[model samples]
Target: MLPLAPSFDTVGWLTRDLATLDRVVRVMLPEGSRAASGAAIPEVLLSVLDPAVVQAFRSAVALLVERGGFDKPDDVELPDVKATYAAFRTVQAAEAWRVHGPWLTEHPGSVSGAVADRFRVAAAVTPDEERRARNVLAEARGALRALLAERTLLLPSAASPAPQASAGGAEVDRVRGATLTLTCLAAVAGAPSLSAPLARVGGAPLGVALVSAPGSDRSLLELAGALVDETAVP
Candidate 1:
């Protein structure tokens, strides 16, 4: 459901088994994989990317190549990745403001303390800043479209393995930028990205994500199914 933000919301599945996910997604999207990419895999990286996440991603990419007949992942260059993420941050937060500002004003106590504070930042988002963010998005998306036209980039869904329930708030905030950096690539580009349950680190699930050209949602999902069929989960 991409109601508040349709473009950024690619079809995502968080299931125990990606093979079962294939059956359900194909039924829902009803799209074939003929047009799905057959190009060399390109896995973009941010400087802030954690080594562990990179290790897991490399293992998954290797599996995709050895078993699924996919190409090896290459390093693709992105401009000002940190800036790209910040721009997306502005765009999403501004959109969130429009969705919740009025409701929150009338019902102040409906939201939690941390979220309520974030809403304040959203409230302060200026129109000029949003326009600038849109410009950044436009430029990046054009380059990204050309770069990913025939390739898929692999990445980790988060900077680390799954977070513990009892982790500190300060800790979460500290690593928040790295966690969102890779995911924001697809978000800002308005492209399709699929997060497959491929990697496990520290006994917890570590998702391996794929980013492709815009409007490639079904193709991306097809690739996800292919990955599931090829790679052994355990």
Candidate 2:
């Protein structure tokens, strides 16, 4: 909520169960939401990923259909994953720079060198680059909104299992990059994405996400609750 990038920033919270999440959603969002409604995982999204992460995502989708009473997701074509991620990064960075660059400039070394470096790169985003990225984002938003007009797109919350507290920067960045590729779809589309903490990999928890049309968040949460109840162990 600190305005990482206003274009993609949203206010969300952590909840332990779907019931609690529902309570919060009722207070935060208006009622009377209606339904809006992927059979294929993009290879680009799965390429070079950890086997555990890949399996978790696939299993999550299967669970949604096999148990949650949801229909098999339609196999829809997505725009180029790598290109979409790049454009999202550009717009996010440019907006972030617009928000925080002045403060960062005034306070040298107040933040980590890596954080400062990222802001520096953001500061350097050119007008032409931002414009191109905006165009790409516009197209992607349309494509995704249309795709979700009648169906939800399911996804993994991250591309890798949780890393150790002491994980190196390179390992962290690798996970972050892959995770962003999966998440940036909803961000670029400006859609509502809900994650159900219903999957595990080698006993570690991983969440599966449901992305849907903008006004369909309440219904999406109801679907997520169904997934949780359906998959819960006796």
* Tens digit of per-residue lDDT, candidate 2, span 205-234: 887878877787788888666666643721
lDDT of each: 0.71, 0.79
lDDT of 1 by residue, 163-202 (tens): 6778787777656767887778877777667776678776
Q: Model 2: which ten-residue window has the lowest total lDDT?
A: 32-41
* lDDT, candidate 2, at 53: 78
What TM-score does model 2 achieve against the real structure?
0.91
Candidate 2 Cα outliers beyond 4 Å, as residue runs: 37-44, 230-234
Error at 75, model 1, angstroms? 1.2
Name every residue pair that clashes in candidate 2. 37-150, 37-151
How many clashes show up per model?
A: 0, 2
Where is model 1 more than 4 Å wrong at Cα?
A: 30-46, 229-231
TM-score of 1: 0.85
**True-vs-predicted CA distance for residue 85, candidate 2, Å:** 0.6
lDDT over C-alpha atoms for residue 178 of model 1: 71
